[model samples]
Target chain A: MTTTPLSPTQRTTIGRGRNRMVEDRAELHRLLDDALIAHLGVVVGGHPVVLPVAFAVDLDGPDEDGTLYVHGSVAAGWLRGAADTTVCVTVTELDGLVAARSAFHHSMNYRSAVVIGTARIVEDPVERRHALGLTVDHMIPGRDATLREPTRKELAATAVLAVPLHEASMKARAEGPVDDAEDIEAGVWGGVIPVGRVFGAVVPDADATGPVPADVVRRARAR
Target chain B: MTTTPLSPTQRTTIGRGRNRMVEDRAELHRLLDDALIAHLGVVVGGHPVVLPVAFAVDLDGPDEDGTLYVHGSVAAGWLRGAADTTVCVTVTELDGLVAARSAFHHSMNYRSAVVIGTARIVEDPVERRHALGLTVDHMIPGRDATLREPTRKELAATAVLAVPLHEASMKARAEGPVDDAEDIEAGVWGGVIPVGRVFGAVVPDADATGPVPADVVRRARAR
Candidate 1:
């Protein structure tokens, strides 16, 4: 667990639902680990553009707080535009659907983390290679070790950006619906439908030989 | 099926992966329907801010093509900042994790749709009510029919923004990993681990009475 509290700048601070704001740094790390994809927002042509990208977090890396790595093809316009610019990276896990007695009270149970910071392109070869390994292993642990090293040409074709996790905020809602007393007394059925990601069977390619690796199988069976 | 093709503006055109660009208007509708949440990107204080929002798409609504409605508390700063401004709304479904022979080729199979346009606040009471119903039913089909109508105060406390689906783009990756011939011959495990959202059993609220509704049960059992 990190000792530092989430440093929410003027914009990162929660203004509306203050009750849902989370201050524990450990919780922020857990949410980042659990999320599979992050919605990265960057300004393009003076307009905000959001795109889904795979991400990895380096909890103990050299940064004010930590480092968040997001990669894309070097040819991606968004990646090129985001370098050295203030970007917002948001990761959300929808836990459940909150059904309330009144349509006005319907809501969703979710955990979302937002990191606002300047995204800098990783130039150091060693750090870029490490970030690439983390990105690959984030999806399936221990699988990166079995893969061949990235060729110099392949490394040149990928762009990895690192954003410091300092200016960040997390908000979560995990409870049942809060309906009005009158609506509750009306006897309308209300509950929560839990939602989660499930991994299906691992399908090997036609050219793949031998049994699926143990790490891959374990990841498939997890959760 | 809709007769219109997606109008890709200067920014909406997919520049990096042209092969993954999906042009069929019907595919766009299907992707929007399958996705549960949308990442709403709005410029706040001259920085791009993205938030996860529950969204509903109306295929025959009044607009250039159709209307995409997203709602939040009236007190939300982002919602207020987004009014009458150009906002980018993105919805993505992570279908599978593509594990390749080389770490450089690791990727994900996903379907994503991006809609960029000016967001207008829905002020018409009738249209607001209809959009509210669509938002509720978007979570669970036919759920709006069983809930109590939103009171005037509740309606006043909510802010609903509509963006025309005219400037939009859809991209998807569905196949196995594209590894190099050398990597394939090396015989490293390569395949796709399918990822999907699953709904668990419904947990009724402590005050909720009677059996779970049929629609709720059906939704829980879906996928």
Candidate 2:
């Protein structure tokens, strides 16, 4: 965790004006874990490309802080488009919309982390398996244990890339709107419209058999 | 609306399995409008740079389709780096997390649109004013009219980029877990966990303001 590769960027520097930036590693991990999806940005033929991809967090290991793993189908043009290129990956959660009296100040109060690093293709067989396990477990806890292991063919169809979570900055603005002093007296609706993701109960399909796993129930209930 | 630039490589056909892709102009505009933020993917120095940016939908004209308008401080490196270059913009809303019997089938149901096009700066005063108005109205209706207009200096400090809504695709997946017929008998808690954005009632600040505007109050309550 002391490695410069894993150190979180300082709030004062990376996240300038927004004084509410989070610099702690735990906070950054929490945001990454809670993120259901990530937008993968990569360069191809001198053009910038962004792709929405599923991701899993590897938070409990020697490499926990060293890097965050992302994987995609080998057929993915996005992955092939950016081999050995540096990328800036970002995750954002729109907490709410801050509605202020003046237009210049109105903004979305959000929690976001921007990670800058080069992506390296994972090569070691052991590491590749670990990455795949983390990827599957990210979507459904306890799934790796319950399902059949991927065959060689399946592994060939996948490609894993590791990006160090260093040079990262997390900034957020959560308070209600900061209205101008004079506009505060202008009689305008100025405050926050709290917006966030809400989870609905698990909807079991009609054809499914067997009991729900404790892990699924736990995560769903926690939400 | 039907211009296709010749590329040495073939036009990437979206996966047949993922063929609900939308190419209609109206559908693309609706998807972009619903999204408050977009991941702007641009290339800088041969690397992929993806940054989260606030954006508004600029309807091209009464007869034209529309364009996505994204603006930022003139000093923002990510924004400024993209001047006159082609960029990829993506807007996504994760509707739910789908859990299936097997890990391979687990997926998420989301609505996302990817726009790949050339970036052009909005420099003309008339178009700049129009873009600014759309930007403000996109965040909060009528607030633009109520606030002080942007002075020349403020306008000079901001840069707006418009990416035409013409060449784009909107792809959405909304089904529950797609478990194998045989695996459906494995008795797993497999279904969809719905998620979405919720807006709360507007909470006016305590600083002694005038009455809330009728339109603002009406919209807040309506939400």
Candidate 3:
């Protein structure tokens, strides 16, 4: 794994003209870390298929550039077909709703990262187990520590894929909506409405043995 | 324009090992309506390309099934190439985080709609105008009534593509984490933390602006 920042390949470049590209590699990691789900796109059965999946990044590795770990049941047809193939994982965080004076100029202030790489299924038992641990920790800081480690049978039932984060790029539009010069005087209200994702109150399970874990409560309140 | 409820083709069925499929048409509509952006996927340059775009649905249409309107600059190379080609538009709403006792069952409570159809670039003057109107109205309800409608030149500079909502399906997994019986007694807390997307205070654009428009305030508050 290359610890260096991701260098944009031709495929990762935004070639279509609206150049709202983010050049920093750290920004890409920030967007990915803050995300809960990623839209995973793969060419399946001769067409493009995009599905949302839970994902985590491997920061524990010594490499500066980390791998994205996405897991599912071994029996998932999509996961089975996705391995050893190019997959595009996209994470988008919409910051604000840009309300431009002109309808044409209206846009959203969003930060989006697109990571394209071949997903390789982890075959090594030790690596798979570690990846599973990282998956839970990524979603919640102190989660994996408290849960029971996966048994050998449990591990066998799951499939985890490691996607290298080499070919990646981030694009964002993060300012107030740009209105036309003439429309500024058109007496219309134009501004940006901050769009925030926050975690609400915790809903305990029906048969929980105790109160919500301290870490869960802390993370939810922080959000 | 098919007014009948959308009839799913073979492609829309969930054939994977674990099926959290939703067969309700109304549920699909609800997910699409409440979303801010849809990841529109089309094979571009011989690879799967997914782009986030602002979209609107035409429920007011005579067809029982609706259409998804996604607009972009006419100069956009991808849009020009995407016309009359099969496209997959997916809208996802992450409702909560399901923290199962075991890491394997940890999942997200989400509602997603996937629409597969050939996107048609609107050409007819009337329909093109209507599609553009739907695009703005979808983002901010009752917005176009206040802002100046697109001029002839502005309309010519923009391209709007309408993808039929006929071949569509919804899938969701909204429940508490499912942990094993043994893990339940292991005493690690298991529950759900509801995730909510809310709009924060509005930031008015520079220069002359009256009070924030009632409609904008209303939309922001409703979110």
Candidate 4:
């Protein structure tokens, strides 16, 4: 398989009227890596469907292209139909908004990535195993070794799709709103209302469990 | 302007391969209302488009016959197209998954609402005012009164659409996996793992030198 690095496309633009689109892979990776959940948009019967799913990032192995691997049941209607089909996967973090004096200038300060590409299903056993390993590790590093291996039957039912980080665009807005020079005279309550996510202390299972995993503790606190 | 209340005929059911379907409005409303954000699926050029947006519930002023009014900007292509067009709006919250002994029975515990309808644009000033109020209080309850009233210029630029909650169906999977009788006999590491949003302490604006509002405090802890 040829690994094609993504280039900025004609559709990626910044602001309301198409002003600031960032096509850098590093910026795209940063936004994707930081996001725990993503909204997956797929077409079913000509109507659009969007589903929020937990995803894992694979930065190693045959997926040397830094592919984002998302999986669901092989029987899942959305996943089953997505294979070899162009899918739009968006990861958006609304960091803040530039509330400007002019309604025309109102814009959100966000870090968003739109990946448009054909998703291919992982078929090989080795690749599937590797993908599953990456997924488990990404969800909770070091949990793969502790969890029981999937049975043959379990492997048969699972489905994993790989969407290359190629064809992706990352766009962001951070500065205060670009108010019209004329609008500046209009006293409006305008400023950046920052948005963020915070994780609380991890609540360990109350059952007769062994000592808490250090990795889990560290990651939870970091969040 | 007509406010239509959707009956069962307006509802659509999305089924898994063959077995289950849920059709309930109360369940749908709770799921949609609980979510902090929604990914609106719109189709452009016969392709699927999905964008994340914030929405609020309008409870005080019913549209004619107690229909739930969901409002947004007229400038928004999605909202504009949604009005008088067949659209699908889905709201989902993945609480967790309940693993079971049988792989086939492994299930996620989630609350989801999928509404299919044509949105109506509210042009009447009296109705529009109430819809705007709902949108404002939906985010910050008392802020509507505290903030400056919208000027005619602001209102002129804004557009609000209302989608009735009538023709919506809510589907949920909230219990432990229903493993087959044969699988139930087999021992497996199976149970539900819960997930949800936990709001942090309310952060007041640094410049807001006044006492913390009671409404803000109540809403923060209510969540």
Task: Using DockQ, give the best candidate's number.
Answer: 1
Q: Which stretches of candidate 2 lie over 4 Å from their true place?
A: A3-21, A60-64, A140-153, B1-18, B61-64, B146-148, B206-223
TM-score of chain A of each: 0.97, 0.85, 0.94, 0.84
**Where does model 4 sit among the CAPRI classes?**
incorrect
Clashes of each: 0, 4, 5, 2
Error of 2 at B26 (Å): 2.9
**TM-score of each predicted structure versus truth:** 0.98, 0.86, 0.95, 0.75
- Kindly indicate the candidate among 1 and 3 with the higher lDDT: 1
Error of 3 at B102 (Å): 1.2
Worst 10 residues of 1 chain A by lDDT: A1-10
| DockQ of each candidate relative to the true complex | 0.89, 0.55, 0.73, 0.22
Best-to-worst ranking by TM-score? 1, 3, 2, 4
Task: Compare the candidates by TM-score and give the number of the best one.
Answer: 1
The C-alpha stretches of model 3 lying farther than 4 A from their native spots are: A1-7, A17-19, A60-64, B1-7, B17-19, B60-64
How would you encode candidate 2's per-residue C-alpha lDDT over B1-223 as one tens digit per residue?
A: 3333212122223543455565455656666666778998887666666777788876643213467788777766667677788898889988777877765666788888777777877787667666777777776666678777766776776678888755566678888887766677655557777776667666666663667666456445542
Score candidate 3 by DockQ.
Answer: 0.73
Candidate 1, residues B130-160, lDDT tens digits: the string is 9999998999888999877899999988789
* Model 4 pairs in collision: A14-A20, B74-B159
In model 4, what lDDT does residue A154 have? 70
